[model samples]
Every structure is written in C-alpha cells, then in structure tokens.
Target chain A: EDQVTQSPEALRLQEGESSSLNCSYTVSGLRGLFWYRQDPGKGPEFLFTLYSAGEEKEKERLKATLTKKESFLHITAPKPEDSATYLCAVLSNQGGKLIFGQGTELSVKP
Target chain B: EAGVAQSPRYKIIEKRQSVAFWCNPISGHATLYWYQQILGQGPKLLIQFQNNGVVDDSQLPKDRFSAERLKGVDSTLKIQPAKLEDSAVYLCASSLTQGRFYNEQFFGPGTRLTVL
Candidate 1:
C-alpha cells in the first residue's frame, strides 16, 4: 500500500534556528513529491514539487529535496511566520491522487 | 488569479443529519479534488474529477457521500446521515491538469464540519 510518513510530529525552535522535516514514503511508483505549508484555520498552501531523486527546489527560506524513498523540507533561520504545519504528499502512478503524510507541526518562538 | 473557493467556512450539525459543501476551482483548471481532513492529520482525498468526469472516488464512502461537478466547473459534495466520525474539515483543490508531469494543486480555505 502507498503511504507517507513524517517524523517529529511537533517541533519547537527559537527564532533563527534551522532544521529539516522528513517525509518517507512507500509507493508503487513515484511520480512526484509535494510540500505544503498550512496555517491555522486555512488550507494548505503549495510550496514545491520534486519530481526525481536528487531534485531540489527552493523559495526564500525554505528548500525541498527529494530522493527515491523520502523527501525533506529544510527551513533556514526560521522566523515566527515560518511556524506552520508542513505537509508532504506523493503522487503515484501518474494519477491525480495524492498520498499525504500526517504532517509536522513547527513552532518558532522569538 | 483567484484561488479555489469553498462555501460555508464552518457548519455544525447533528448525527444522522445531511449537509453539503461547495467548491469553485480556479478558472480554467482541468482537475478538481475534494478531501477530508481530520484534526491533526493530513487531508485525505475523497474524490477527484477531471473536466466533469470522475477520475477517482475510491476513498469516498459511497453509501453516504456523493459529489458532482457539472459543466466542469463548480462542484458539490454531500453527506447524508452524517456520523460523528464525519466531523472534519472539507477541503477543495484544483490543478491545471493531472498526469505524470508536474502539477501543483491550489487549495481553498476549507469548510470545518462539526457533528454532535
């Protein structure tokens, strides 16, 4: 069965801290891996899509890297604004369906 | 561009009651999706549509859940005889297209449903 797993269910860091969130997956065939940021009372906001192993994408303070079995979202010197639930999802078999991870709740305190 | 839109940001209902949620995908998007997200968990795809055609509804509880997208535009998801377990946020998302290629999904604010 295809599934996504994210570790460190919750994390707290002082502002300016850097860390990485992991998203491991078991799928029949990997089409793409996605990263999303969701704030309270809101739906997820698209962040990045990694299509292949060794692929990497970045936006401002966030960077996403993908491998055959897992993906990572690295935050650089995160601020309070960066505190949100980060979600990971995998698209398999080239279909519209997405198998999502439980997500990691991040908290950055000043 | 406007993102996906959902109606009734929140709803409270009793078990066995029926309710419906609506969604309007981004203009020109060819694919739309509805998901159920329980608190502390990621969204789970309940159904997916491509231009008014059903691409997937494997996870939807067909016995109590039904959805339709007419004219390949706005869509509606309805639940009859709701259960306590049905309490969750309903999220709608859309993408330009779906395939092996890269497609980014944009989501709406979501409708929170609370069943007592």
Candidate 2:
C-alpha cells in the first residue's frame, strides 16, 4: 500500500522564525513527491516536485528537499502571509495516483 | 492561460438532496482530475480522465456518484443523494499529460459543498 504521513499536524511560529515540515511516505515506487500550499476556502496550489534523493527546489522563502524515505519543506523567516496548509503527496508508480499526507497546518504570526 | 474554471463556488443543501458541479480544464490539457478535500485534510483523488476516456475511477463511490467528460474539455460530477459526510471542497485539476514524472497539475478555485 502507498501511504504518506506528515509530522506535527500543526505548527505555530512567530515572524522571522524558521521551521521544517516533514512528509514521510511508503510506496511501491516513488515516482515523484509533490508539495502544495492550500489556503482556507481555496484549492491547493502546486509548490515543488522532487523526483530523486538529494533533490531540492526553492521558491521565495520556501525550500523542499527529498530523500528516499521522506521529504521535508523548510521555511525561513516565515511571515503571516505564509500561513497555509502544506500538503505532501507521493505519486505512486503502481496506480499512477498521488497519495497525500494529512498536511501540516502552519500558522505564522507577526 | 486563464487556469481551470469551476462553477458554483459555494453550495449548501441538506442530506439526500442531489447536487452537481462542473469544471472546465485548461485548453489542450489531456488529463483532468477530480479531488475531494475535507476541512483540515489533504485532497484525495476521486477520479481521473485522459481526454474523453476514464483513466482511474476506482476510488469513486459508484452507488450514487457519477461523472462525465463528454467533450474531453469540460466535465461534471453528480451526486444523486448527498450525505452529511460529503461536505467538502471538490477540486478540479488538469495536466498536460498523464505521465507522473513530469506532470504538474493546475488546480481550480474548487466548489465548496456544505451538506447539512
């Protein structure tokens, strides 16, 4: 079975504080790992897609790194505007479907 | 490009009432997907369509749920009798191809359904 799990269901941080969100997965074959940002009342927006171990992608203050067993999304100097649910999903090669984690609800307070 | 479009940004109805939602994918997108996201949860794939054909609908509850992409451009999801547990946001996404490696899905604003 393909499964994705995220840690620290929720996180609270003050402005300028840095933190990392974890996304661990167990799949038959990890085709790709994806990160998405979803705000309340809105659908998810794609962030980064990591294909192999040691791969990294960045956008603004967000950085995503991937390893064989899991992935991590590190936020630097987070602001209130960066508050949103960060979702991690693994594209399973078997079904060609993305199995998603429960998501990490991040709150960045000023 | 103008991203994916969806209808009925918000809908509220009692259980047992039927409802339908629509989505129009980006022009020329070969693959379309439907996902359900409950509050505080990640999106779950409900169905996937490649062009006008079904790619995967295994997770869809066939008892009272049905969907169609008649023209391979726009699609509709219908629930004959909704349940309270059905309250969630229905998201529609599309990608250039069905390949998982290079596929990056573009999502819509989604239709929020509240079943009372």
Candidate 3:
C-alpha cells in the first residue's frame, strides 16, 4: 500500500525562526514528490516537485530536499505570511493519482 | 492565467438531500480531478478524467456519487442522498496531461459541504 505521512502536525515559530517539516512516503514506484502551501479558505498552491532522490529545489525563503524514503521542506527565517498548512504528495509510476500526507500546520508569529 | 475555478464556495444541507458542484479547469488542461477532503486530513482522490474519458473512479462511491465532464473543458460532481460522513470540502484540480511523467496540478478554492 502506498501512503504518505507528515510529522509535527502543528508548529509555532517566531517571525525569524527557521524550521523543517518532514514528509515520509512508501510507494511501489516513485515518480514524483510535490510540496504545496494552502492558506485558510483558499486552495493549495504549488511549491516544488522532486523527481528523484538527492534532488533539491528552492524558492525565496523555502527549500525542499528529497530522499528515497522522505522529503523535507525547510523554511529559513520564516515570516508571518509564511504561515499556512504545508502538504506533501507523491505520484506513483503505477498511476497518476497523488497520495497525500495529512499536512503540517505552521504558524509564524510576527 | 486564470487558475482552476469552482462554484458554490459553501453549501449546507440535510442528510439524504442531493447536491452538485461545478468546476472549470485551466484553459487547455486535459486532465481533471475531483477530491474529497475531510477536515484535518489530506485530500483523497474520488475521480479523475482525461479529456472526457474516465481514467479512475475507484474510490468514488458509485451508489451516491457521480461525476461528468461532458465537453472535456468543465466538470460537475453530484452526490445524491448525501450522508453525514459526506460533509467535506470537494476540491477540483487540473493538470496539463495524464502522462507517466510529472505533471503539476493546480487546485481550485473548493466547495465546502456541510451536512446537518
């Protein structure tokens, strides 16, 4: 069975604090790993896509790194605007459907 | 470019009633998807369509749930005789293609359904 799990269900950080959210996945054949940020009352916004292990991608204050069994989304000196639920999803070669994690709720207090 | 669009941002209804939600994917997108997201949980795929052809609908409860993408540009999902457990956010997403490789999916604001 393919599944995705995210740790630290909720996190609170200061305006300039840095932290990392984890996403662990188990799938038959990994095709891609994705990260998305979702704000309250809005849909999720795409962040990054890692196609293979040892791959990394970054945008502004966010960086995402991938491994064979897990992925990490690192937030550097996050601001209040960065506060949102981060979701992780994995696409398997067996199908186009995405297996998603429960997501990590982040709060960056300014 | 405009993102995926869904109508009726919120709906409240009694159990056993029927309801429907609509979605218009980004222009030129060939792949569309519908998902059910319960509060505090991840979005679960209910149905997927590739250019008006059904790609997957394994998780959809056929007894009460049905969806259609008549023209391959827009889609609608209907739930008849809704149950309490069906109260959740129905999200619509779209991708450029239904290929083996990676295809980024764009999501809509979603229709929040509350069954009383």
> Among these predicted structures, which one has the highest TM-score?
3
DockQ of each: 0.93, 0.85, 0.92
lDDT by residue (tens digit), candidate 2, B49-99: 999999999999999889999879999999889999999999999999876
lDDT of 3 by residue, B1-116 (tens): 99999999999999999999999999999999999999998899999999999999999999999999988999999999999999999999999987756678999999999999
Clashes per prediction? 0, 0, 0
Chain B TM-score of candidate 3 stands at 0.99
Task: Residues A46-83, candidate 3: write the lDDT tens digits.
Answer: 99999999999999999999999999999999999999
Interface RMSD of 2: 0.9
Output the TM-score of candidate 3. 0.99
Residue A4 accuracy (lDDT) in model 3: 98
Q: Mind giving the per-residue lDDT tens digits that candidate 1 earns over A1-110?
A: 88999988999999999999999999888888899999999999999988889999999999999989999899999999999999999988745588899999999999
Worst ten-residue run, lDDT, model 2 chain A? Answer: A91-100
Superposed Cα deviation of residue A10, candidate 2 (Å): 0.9
The models' CA-based lDDT, in order, is 0.94, 0.93, 0.95
- Candidate 3, pairs of clashing residues: none
